[model samples]
Target: MKSRRFMQPLTSPIHFHTAMIEQTPVAVFLGQEMIGSGKIVQITDYIVKIGNEFYVRDACTFKYAV
Candidate 1:
């Protein structure tokens, strides 16, 4: 007998523009690993401030966090 695996639905990346507008807490992930979590405090053209750390807006992925 063969085993079947379930696949998850694909989701879109959370853009900085949307995040800035929503102003919600997010989990910061580099690839599949979560590096940090915090609420967005500020945003610039190429950077985002989450808590006390600044990350290049495009270098990491952001997802809504509890």
Candidate 2:
């Protein structure tokens, strides 16, 4: 006899764009001022805007190396 495995939908790592992989709503904040509305700009980047300030995905700090 063979066993069957179940598949899941709406999993993580949702495709953000063609030929690219990105996860949405990874980072979010409230009552913070930024420029531009929150949007996914790149597979691994995002453009966030709050109140009157803007922030790019490059604001994150690095801690691990490949």
Tell me each candidate's TM-score: 0.63, 0.22
Highest-TM-score candidate:
1
Instruction: For each candidate in turn, give its C-alpha RMSD to the true structure in angstroms.
Output: 8.0, 12.1
Model 1 Cα lDDT, one tens digit per residue, 1-66: 321211221134345456556665677777888787777777776767888998775787766663
For residues 1-66, what per-residue lDDT tens digits would candidate 2 score against the true structure?
321211111122342241122222223323342223323444334533333444443553111110
The superposed Cα distance between candidate 1 and the true structure at residue 22, in angstroms, equals 5.8
**Candidate 1 TM-score, true structure as reference:** 0.63
At residue 11, candidate 1 shows an lDDT of 31
Global CA lDDT computed for model 1: 0.63
Model 2: worst 10 consecutive residues (lDDT sum):
2-11
Winning candidate number (lDDT)? 1
How far is 58's C-alpha from truth in model 1 (Å)? 1.1
